[model samples]
Target: MSNDDINARRREQVELNMLTVAAVAGWYIDTYLDKKSCRDSALSGAAYVNELLIGHLERFRQVCRMERPIFMKLCNVIRSKNLLCDTRDITLEEQLIMFLFTIGHNAVNRQVQERFQHSGETISRHFNGVLQAILSLSTQYIRDPSINVPIEIANDTRFYPFFKDCIGAIDGTHIPVFVESHKQAPYRNRHGLLSQNIMAACTFDLKFIHIQAGWEGSASDAIVLRAAEKDGFKVPRGKYYLVDAGYGNTPNYIAPYRGVRYHLREFARGSIGPQDAKELFNLRHSSLRNAIERVFGVIKNRFPILKNTSSHSFDTVTDEDINEPDDDYNTDERRREGNRMREAIANAMCDEYSIHTRRLRDRHGH
Candidate 1:
């Protein structure tokens, strides 16, 4: 009698467990069927493009980090080049817009999907597609400056005669980058943050002429400059570029005097005037080179995501990366010549600076 009763009770418990499992499974299936797709919304990708087509200029710029006309021009370029085409449901403009919105805000695929009312896969496809198209056009837009003297130096009294041969400013900035734990050591800068060392050559008007990106954060400015030269970034013969002390003081790549107050801050806020010609030269040099710093600031202000770029994992190297053979430059002889040239320039600047100082003191009755 005891065995029979135990066996019957065990069977009843098993049957009850099976019924509970079935009930839970049925609930999950019903919930899945009732749930709405994340992409189901009123403002579709096409609809958003149409709104932007008729929207205010400032509003479009605020959303895309570029003017609407520039945005349209980019779309036209990609389309004219046959790099991108209108999908059945989305136009070429919408495709480029999705990519721009994603990068402009550093929005991830999911965020973009929500904004454009499309599946994550769809958003990712167009984003990468537009990215490729833009990369293909880099050579067309980014180029070396013409051999002529830029107006910023040609027209300004402070720089005119001395910097008449100066073409632009060269500087390096660090941008956050993601890499594998083992690969992160190279990207870890002295500040203990993982970043990429991006070298920029820009005109005084805050326009980038040449950009060499994707270097490790720990990479030195000199190394990046060498790499850039190998990749065909040229400083015209007899002309030079203004750089900070981090770069080599070599021919056609002039750098500030090391161990001197070269940054603008050293001269601002009622700071003492330059003690000598070398100091004076550094002060003015830094002032002109400050254009590159301003360009970096402007870029970050326009795209705030650049300040903290944790949303996207930029771990891959694209075809746009330069892998050219090293260009033998910055040799000892070249550097020594560059130093002599710098000393001459500094000495030449002293007479003008003294004359300007005399005029200022006389005007102030000092």
Candidate 2:
């Protein structure tokens, strides 16, 4: 062969040898480890998982952060997809439980290894395996936002018709995180706490339709939201999302009136009610937008990992199933149009509320 051809052949032989070595290394690692830090507990991870799953349904829910049925269903889905398999010593149940226990309780690898009676290497491997499986099933679990008005808005007397086009709510939250010292500046929020910014869109019933996570905590809510929009979060034609003023407004987003009384506390009992159309709109807007806040509360409470810092380098939600966000809409025009829509909706709601109030007054002879 020519000199150039001989070099090419040598390079190909080297690549083949590298692949062979890599395959052998992967197989050996899977089967063996060098003095792996092992945990020995009387209650093996498998036994503990079985006890929790078969003993009491409530206990399972408390530990797994999900009902027994849901947990089993998830296991079935992952196994069916060949995402996990039962090993000789550790069953698939143990694998999933380790993941759930860790994320649900914010347990570190050491804690998880202790509970499961497994080596740190095995624990981390299985944990990552289960996590990847769960992420793969995102399409089935993280459903699409319905284009139609949500039942909560459609059936509620106070919100129906007025918010008939509202399909969901959107908001951003800060999730505690750990980052390298060199990268810590971007992760620090205004309060000087390290965190990641997360923006999520959810239906009125508290189901997340889309999420944009992993932005630095210092990022603005608007910035995260814009990124989410770019990543396939779309508002249906003529549909809008309820947002706090901090989230900003777009043609498909209805932000509560700024510089007005918008908080639920400001409208509590014994406090003066909204006195004008603007205030009325702000009050109702706040009421509806509170759904996003509640969603965050429920999520953080359920996944303590989100509420606290992680032992790992960092964690982030991967919205792999979301589509590329469409940025075709003219933002300036959308804002102008959204303003007009808000004004019209406010006036219409004010008129109807006035009539309803008068009717109540007359019926009660107030």
Candidate 3:
């Protein structure tokens, strides 16, 4: 074929695809505006196509500058179709954004097929590719902190009276996912369901300093921590990562001193020993390190998807639904088991650390 003919064919494909996508978008907009009521439509298939095509073409000229590949593809297809006639509908940018809105709202390939007049396979392929692109582009937003410690909390007064050097809080949480048989042994949690292990280090401002996702659910919090250390997450001079009892008592990983009362309750009720300055120091350290729990609460609440197990197995499901499969498999029992393991480790560490913190406090006093 001549260059002109090839160009003409490409343009035709673009027009056909955009009209299909716009039809799908219109159905989505109606569904959202209608508040999802039970309904059926009597509109003929041909009429629906004509109406959506006209609507898409009417707005085509205005959205030519969109950078999304899907939108650009739609615009080119529509433009090619328009070459055989006059007047364009739905500009490239509008078509792309509209397509995105459909994917977000509808989230089903069959729905896209019914509304946009494309095969389910075509919609699924296009949708998954676009979703990956969107995620890849947005990854730029999840940045690590530059200074490590925020300026507001850097001064002596802010950390004052209790501890002088504090940086970020560290914790680990289980992200539930479908059991991939190949990795089933490693991914299995205590309760027998599959999950992914994620360890995060967050600062007071909620910015993630370190986030490692995609470990097997069976992995321990300590394992994640060790991996983080191996990956070279720096523990800056004079600053410590506030951790709970799950991690062992090390100079780098500090925990509350046991048998010693903290500010809240350093001296036990039945203790026959005198309440002295040694007791006071342990209390302060425990009080200062509890911020990590709050971080876990906020994250799970916002992304409830993390609270549940994946609905489909990662091994069986396509890439588009991979993240969601983990949420579907979550059960109360699984959640409790995961929570218990994490807490138990933390408490055990605290027991060990309590001994160390008391010794250190006594040494500091001398």
Question: Candidate 1, which segments miss by more than 4 Å at Cα?
Answer: 1-36, 315-329, 359-366
lDDT per residue for candidate 2 within 157-182, as digits (tens), equals 77879998888888889988878899
lDDT tens readout by residue for model 3, 1-366: 899999999999999999999999988766544422332345532345445445665343322222234455644654564421121432333334434534334234455455544444444444444445444543465554454444535553324423334567788877777664676897888888777777788776676777766667777776767666655566775456666566644444555444545534424556533344444435444555555566778666644546776343554222321121222223456445534543444454455556766899999994
RMSD (Å) of each candidate, 1 decimal: 6.8, 6.8, 16.2
| Candidate that would win on TM-score | 2
Clashing pairs in 2: 230-325, 232-325
Q: Evaluate model 2: give its TM-score.
A: 0.86
The true-versus-predicted C-alpha distance at residue 203 of model 3, in Å, is: 0.6
How big is the positional error of residue 208 in model 3, measured in Å on the Cα after superposition?
Answer: 1.3
Query: Quick one: ranking by lDDT, best first?
Result: 2, 1, 3
Angstrom error of the Cα, residue 5, model 3: value is 50
lDDT of each: 0.82, 0.82, 0.54
Residue 346, model 1, lDDT: 91
Compute each candidate's TM-score over C-alphas: 0.85, 0.86, 0.48
Off by over 4 Å in 3: 1-140, 144-158, 258-288, 312-366
